[model samples]
Target: MTLSRRQLLQAASGLALTIGIMGLPALAQAAETVDIDELMKPSPLGDKVLGSEDAPVTIVEYASMTCGHCAHFDEVTFPELKSRYIETGKVRYIFREYPLNQPAYAMSMLARCMPADKYFDGVEIMFEQLRSGALSGTFLPALTKLSKQIGFTQESFEECLTNQKLLDALEAEKTRATNEFGVKATPTFFINGEKHSGALSIEEMGKIIDEKM
Candidate 1:
């Protein structure tokens, strides 16, 4: 992956995490805006919410649909976490788009096309397509199929994709990541305000979640 300036900064932050240290808490306490400019960007889709609004544990994953590691995590890891934590009201798993390529962008757009209630399910379906290598030029076609399964029409799909407001919202998400969140890669995770880069194993994630619990 081509590293951007923001990514380099995140690498430094990750190192701090490795050492069991972070400045975010102190910065928040001081009422200083976190160096992460990404948080300020307004999302057109609002926040991709899962679990309850008041859930104690919030797991936010910034993932690209074209990322194989992300697909793996979605397919293998996320389900278990959802079952054990999110389903039981112990956690809320929120997925935010982090498109790294054109395909990923399309996939993100497709996921957003679903009704708010089905948004995350749409995300899972999109990632499944990506994992199957069917998310290529077949994005719209695949979305059409999934949409049909969920009782959406082709017209609705087209309308959703062509929605300028949604496009602007997604663009805003990308800009926010670059400017505020210091996001530089796909499959980055922020668990309870602590950020993690790269796709970590479920066990590794569980260790952190266990501690938080």
Candidate 2:
């Protein structure tokens, strides 16, 4: 079913309570009031991309690093799709953050704190760390190893995690997500702005991607 961005947003408002309880610092840019059309616009915070921006299909995914379901999708489904569809220019795939834990949120922040070219690279390494089930271990320590590969020193990683501006932007995105997109779970997807709430198999996602192609 198709949903106007406003309608989809209204469906998601209730999920914001948990985020609120974390008491994140208030940001001047928070989407305190939703502007349905504006909120639907793609975020500028991620590595801005242009891949057949007018491509007939657009896929948006909301994921958290600590989530096993998200890790599964990254490991099994995304690579094939990246090779077949993304690299081939048939669709525009947007990876958006929706972290469920403080550590996940910190990882997401570090990923975005770098130059655009390194953003996804950091994310990939961090995901690999999670795949190893290291998040249950000390997050900062595991993240330190991932950081070194990308030239992120302990100081840089800590700074990125504590950056109020970065946190604010992420919170804004999360707020926009919950109050506007009905995203209640990790690995949630939006195919052309229509919502899919949970993880699906690589085969299942491939079938959908094939249909879109």
Candidate 3:
């Protein structure tokens, strides 16, 4: 149903995944800075991006598919971000993978394996599952089931899960984030090269974006 094939595989694999249930932190906390040009460097798998390239503000988020805060941001704040900034040509948003565990690694692979046009759709579904508590059920059996709904068969789903090349690329990005940018948590955002760690609210994000503009 899920990965270990992960978050969904707790029962099948007997693995415990701890999500960050801690409430969102204040945005004023500080972190090491990143060079925007270096931050934009692509991994072997490249990026799954949205928004206009010419937007005045650019946000790069390193997130885990199974992180509770990351899922909550997608369920709540991301839509507004997309509508108000991404879609409106005020911001360019780039999402990168930083899987925290085996299950998350597999989950990230699933998103990357999606068809070109459906990459974001795959990512959205993952977060939706995380947010709505769908993955808490039997994911072992449902893993292929969910994949099939989007055109992946049992064999293909398994193949994608075991794709070492893709897995390695995701790992490389995570390592680079750790060594180069000091990204230690899920949902860490770099707004115009300034570091802020948390599931930021829309008003907080808008303030940063406005400052950039």
| Local distance difference test values of all predictions, in order | 0.63, 0.64, 0.78
Cα error, residue 69 of model 1, in Å, equals 1.3
**How would you encode candidate 3's per-residue C-alpha lDDT over 56-170 as one tens digit per residue?**
8889998888789888888778999999999999999999988877667777888888888899898888777777666664455545566777778788887887676676778
True-structure lDDT of candidate 2:
0.64
What residue runs in model 2 are displaced by over 4 Å at the alpha carbon?
Answer: 1-40, 44-50
Find the candidate with the highest TM-score and give its number.
3
lDDT of 2 by residue, 80-189 (tens): 77777777787778888886756666677778888887677777787776677554444455566676777877788667666766766776787778768866568776
Superior by lDDT: candidate 1 or candidate 2: 2
Question: How well does candidate 3 match the true structure, expressed as C-alpha RMSD?
Answer: 3.8
Weakest ten-residue segment in model 1 by summed lDDT: 17-26
lDDT of 1 by residue, 19-59 (tens): 11111111111112233234423365777866876767777
